[model samples]
Target: MLTLLLLIPIAAEHKPLLLERFRVIDAPDPATRAAAIATRADEIDLVLTNGTVGFKADEIAALPRLRLLAALGVGHENLDLAAARARGVAVCNGAGTNDDCVADHALALLLASVRALPQQGAALRAGIWRDALPLFPHFNRRRLGIIGLGAIGQKIARRAAAFGMVIGYHNRQPRADAGEAVYFDSVARLAAWADDLVVATPGGAATRHIVNAEVLTALGSGGHVVNVARGSCVDTAALAAALRDGRIAGAALDVYESEPRPPAELVGLDNVILTPHVAGWSPQSIEASVMNFVANVEALARGEPLPTPL
Candidate 1:
């Protein structure tokens, strides 16, 4: 049986499924991870991690026999792809498994941010009526720009269709099948054309801070921004500055620069909405992701195509 290191946290209910297949070790915290790998590196053949709990280069060096690295979520920004390639380790991720869940959350953030739902709800609780509150924009019939035109971005576009929002996207290259959604070569250009911009891009050095102050400036005071991708993709300081100066109308995010911790710079902003990095987390998505991990592991063992390799 292959020995697998479980670096990503799993729901207690899902633990038994993986444990039955491989000799498993749960090392979810950073404190225990290095020590666990150090002690069992020779025995570990496969590793399960996520974008946040990424397998590092040093960690890869420790595992002399490591053959596979699977990211439990869609984003694997933290995973060292180059290191994996050097070691001839197969790399896979739970890509399409969580698309719907993340797309749903992106739309939720977009609607909430545009309508100022959370703000108004709080005001109502504080005894203020609708008549006393400032007016907010309607979510529908506006231009929507997606920063990435991947599976999740496409799903978000389909959802936004009901709201009559015109969709556009910015990818490294224009997609031939993007259909009616306009395409842009630059993120800032996409932001300029959009009334609301939703960032669904991958994280990592190539895309880090892809949505910086320039993009925010192009988004303008009438624009709202939502991020459902990796926090590293957006500059937290730039976002905070934009909100402070009204460079953009408002912003919503499920992921920020601070992972497992809230971005302190944004805590005081009334024009912003924040959620824990849970855009792709739901009981359904978690279950799907776990199954995807199992499938990849099984395929690796059998020399078959991986179910989802990124």
Candidate 2:
């Protein structure tokens, strides 16, 4: 039987299927993670981890027989891609598995920020009348700019159309399939041109801090920013400064610089909307993600191509 190192948390319903297929060794918890991983290092043929709970290089070094490394989510930033490549390990991720969930969450954040939902709720609870609070920007008919035009961003655009919003995007190259949507070659230019900026790019060194003070400045005081991508893509300190100085109107973020902990700088700010890094998490999404993992490993066993190779 093929041995597997299950680093990412597997749901109860899916656990039995995976356990039955392979000699699964669980090491997700802190207490058992290191020793468990070490004990089975040489025997593990495949390792499963997530972007945040990424498998390390030293851990990779330990697993001499490791044939595959898969991230349960779209991001595999924490995984040492170079090292994996050097060792001829194939990498894969649950790319399209949770696109809808993440897109829906991004829309929720944007609408909440645009409508001042939190502030409105706070005022109502504090006994303030509706007209006493300042008016919020209308979400409909506004210009929406997405940083990445990948699978999730396309879904976000599809949702945005229902609100009668005009869409623009920034990417390395213009996509012909984007149809009527305008494209910006640079993120800064996109921010300047857009009324609201949405980040949908992946996390990693290439994208780290791509949305910095300069981009925020270009976004102007009337523009709002939304990040549904990795926290590292945006500079937290720069974002905080921009919000505090009113350089940007507002921000809605599902991910931040610190994983597992809220961004300390933005948590106290009224102009920003914060959520736990659950933009891609849902019961349905998780099920789909696990299914993707199962398909990848099973394909590996059959000597066939995986569904979503990273």
Per lDDT, the best of the predicted structures is: 1
Reference-based lDDT, each prediction: 0.90, 0.89
Per-model root-mean-square deviation over C-alphas: 1.4, 1.6
Clashes of each: 0, 0
In order of appearance, the predictions have TM-scores of 0.96, 0.95
Per-residue CA lDDT of model 1 for 160-201, tens digit only, reads 977889999999899998989999989988988999999998
Clashing residue pairs in candidate 2, if any? Answer: none
**Across residues 30-94, which tens digit of lDDT does each residue of candidate 2 receive?**
66779876576778898889988887777788888999899999988888888888888888999
Misplaced by over 4 Å in model 1 are none
Report the poorest 10 consecutive residues by lDDT, candidate 1: 133-142
